[model samples]
Target: EGEWKVMLFTCSYSVGGVHGHLVDYMQPEAVSTLLGMTYGEYDKRYKSYFGDVIRKTFFDDVGFVHMEQTWTPAITEIFREKYGRNPALYYPALFYDIGPETGAARIAFYDIRSELMAEGYVRQVSEWSEARRMRSMGHPPENYSPNSVVAHGDILKYYRHVDIPLLDAILCFRRGLNGFKQVCSAADLGDKPVVGAELCGAYPEEMDSAMLYRTTLEAMARGVNFVVSHGMWYDTDPQTVRIPPLIAPENPLLGPALKGYSTSTGRSCMLLQGGRRIADIAVLWPINAIQAESYMFRDAESGLPIANWHPNDVVNYALSGMLTNDLHRDFTYIHPENLTDGKVSVEGDRLRLNNAENLQEYSVLVIPGGGYISAGALARIGEFYDNGGKVIALASLPS
Candidate 1:
């Protein structure tokens, strides 16, 4: 029973802030209010709001031990009260210390896996189906590919030195194994198919380039099944230095539908059609990109990183999606050194795409986000557009 090889998602989640976003939000009045309530009163209100099963999931099964202390329980209670059961997302929160059990082949988190390693925990990560990636290249690919029990060097390092239960008021080390554990906790309970996480330092520049490549390969060795990019940006948020969403209502017809579609199945179908990508293999392929930094027009210091780790941007992804959607090519690539590697070649104003190995057969060629571009690159782009090629640009504007 594995339904898919990998499951793609955003990683800024946790149970009550246990994983990526666990910050305590306790207040005196919050608990005082909870204690003041009577069980009879609470039960009546609970069912009156949230239907039956959810009422059981929270108050019965879990006892909601500290529902008031954790924001989710309280928030979940509200959702159940009004909407009956919470959306599908409510139960499978990674923070629950209980991973998703939808049974659609399982995927696990690299951040959580790393913590297990540090704490002398082990698992057969390969059994899971989803791709496993870490935020940054913490180690080398050759190191973990076969899923050995060597326990990463950092694990040994921390075992010998570093302290546990330390708090990093700031993101002390976005990629340092210590850094990940400070915020996240394991939820898979030792069951998963393919393993992957939002690997790579928050920004590609955090660790030098060479180190980045090694870390990715290492994730493979550690039994990480795939690497969905940390993210692509919607826009930029300078205060947070995060790659924010490029979230503008960019002509619903031209970009993502401003509104979601009706029916979950219908919504999924529409999302696939709107130039967005829905990958199948769920494998790991690292591309270099700032997680998310959007500075439509700003200076470097003032520049914001679109928050999600989008090593490959929309234009290229859209293009890739077009190829995947339209063509049926069994793929193979000569390991691109970078997103804009020699795949699309340009020599003295002559724009040519060599290594058409997989792409040569496709009718449309879409190249989206790459790093900074030069006048020469624009010229080559113009040439490609002129050659009767269908191209879609996400953040890349015309010359």
Candidate 2:
């Protein structure tokens, strides 16, 4: 039996409860008896080690769960071992400018942190699920905003191992619609068959059938095929409820519409799933620029540390809104890592995004305004431009 202890931290927000942090999920000592083995050895034995739990659960799907701000001393040690340098040395650069190497250090810090999470935790669970004939699904917090860097490292890289990339869509409809394109883009780039939204959890009590249907359809139009309504409650007492908009048959207003909503959503998912997304434009995700531009500084009044808002933070959301709503043109976001890793390439007058199962060709490569870019991605863009592909640079050119 696994005897893992929860690490709790006080909630910073108004929710006012202690948040429990799980073990890094890669920690052999906490998870199983497979201690003192190298990661390679652990990987080989992971499936069989978890066989009893997998068999006992009798579940067709497994979730890796939400990984948000999951960092520890063990992670730092692994980071040092993997990168051959202590991450502590980069702290000055990570938070504030240290000199010429500051940008490079920040880039490396964020990149390695993202890589460690993806390889150490996310990929392990994903591969395990695949081996067990179960599907893996989940999302990191702040998945839809520039805050994704602080929360999940790199949103695109974070989802690389996930079988179904999910986005948490809470709050009101207007606010919830902001980051759907980003998650959908991850699914498209990965060639994953399904994209999920954990929707309508914290909406007001006034949330009606119209609001629910509108939100669902909007999410669907943005490339979501799976919807996990967040969620139904067992207890109907209003006093026991925490998150609002309780989705249950007991709810007097939205209850009667549940059955029909479920049916239509099912049909929608069946039609949208397993199809290649067709788009002529590919927006570069500019994660490199975002990482390079972001830094922490002390707040003026409270004297607390805070992250500065970079101008490029909302560029993705803005571009998505323009292309998707105004221009009526469809597009997908291609990550800078994809370009650097050779998953994306120049094919004559087109840029081809190729993965294990899906291939998408874009005629126009739209690079949004960010002053910094990875050299490898820049080289790929140059090659594409030289090969006669349309290159659109928004705001300013990346240095």
Candidate 3:
């Protein structure tokens, strides 16, 4: 029998508190409660509402076991319990909306509805996916790309746990080459060993094989491995569907164009996967700074980060987007928490990642500006500098 890989496309758990959103919230007072707090206060405690709540209820020492009755014993196994099922390759096709006012509204809705479980789901899903991937002979689980142009920093943050970073680069139409470059570069630097995650959104309406070939090569150059076309629809009547020609047979490009795309990108994936990267530059993610900026804007139209948004403030967002472009050498994110937690340490004038199997070393740490920072992280940076590690602060010191 042939193997089948299933793709589950859904809103990322990070968008709202995990127990599902309380979209039909009853209380107007709840919105007032959410708006009452300053962004800083919200930033520190947003997880308390969502992530922490789920961690206590769903996960335990043995890992994520499906204990909730609502999820189990259901006809479809909606909670994704893998028991009694054949081992099959599975990957998440994730998406979410953007903008500042939009993000603020999501947080407001969660606060009003008392559904604080959304923020922490991404990490939880990452853990669950890792466990499932281990159970699968060798199939890997790709990560969900963060929503919006500014929120892209979250994609880099995802690298800490996942091997693949899947981005829906075409959805925005605003996201073009610059966007894809930033995304692929981040994934290449992350834990992704050899093969990067699938890059979706190559539509025939957008471009044919020639454009596809060039795009695939560009991604490969930036370190993307596997490729999945934007999508294929079910065999319903062509008139019924809005977007067609997506490998739907009737689409004129399906015959040779699809075949050529599959052939070219598939071969490139084999050549790129399983390779190690070497880098001397460490990009320090301005975690607090990004959070600080995200609070300043509220985008109700799209939804808040469910937890928080990106470094929307001009300085940090622009800096982060272009930070890796001309670095000339490979670079990886230096999580501030990791620095404080000792996951990153100084060794003989070089900063080293302590947790990886092979160990990654970096000589320079570039900190993007504009966020509230922890004293512990500041001390760690001081330690790095004292140990002869180089530092590049974009505009202002973290404070």
| Candidate number achieving the greatest lDDT relative to the actual structure | 2
TM-score of each: 0.21, 0.80, 0.57
Task: Sort all candidates by lDDT, best to worst.
Answer: 2, 3, 1
Residue-level lDDT of model 3, residues 1-399, one tens digit each, is: 799754553322212443334221112243234333432254356544533433211111110111111111121232134234321221110013334333333322222111112113334334543433321011111122222222222444433443445444343222343334444544544545443323335344644556556656655655567665544566536575455335444565544677656776778788777646566777775545543333222322336432224444324344434644544345566666777777778786788876454357888887766545667878888888998889887766644
Using TM-score as the measure, what is the rank order of every candidate, best first? 2, 3, 1
Give lDDT tens digits, candidate 2, residues 1-399: 799644333222213223353444444344333222433464476666554554211111112223223344555566577678866766666556778777777777667667766665566656656766566778876565544565566777778888888886777785636567888898888889898888888888878988889888888888899988875777878777788788888787889999999999999999999967788899998777777755543112223222224454337667888887788788889988787777888889898888766678899999878877888888898998999999988887866
Better of 1 and 3 by lDDT: 3
Candidate 2: where are CA atoms >4 Å away? 1-22, 25-89, 297-308, 312-314
Off by over 4 Å in 1: 1-342, 346-353, 356-362, 367-372, 395-399
lDDT of the structure predicted as candidate 2: 0.70
**Model 1 residue 108 CA deviation in Å:** 35
Q: What is the lDDT of residue 267 in candidate 3?
A: 83
For residues 69-163, write the lDDT of model 1, one tens digit per residue. Answer: 12223333444554565434533432232333321111112122223333321111111101221111122111211111112212211121111
For the record, the alpha-carbon RMSD of candidate 1 to the native fold, in angstroms, is: 23.8
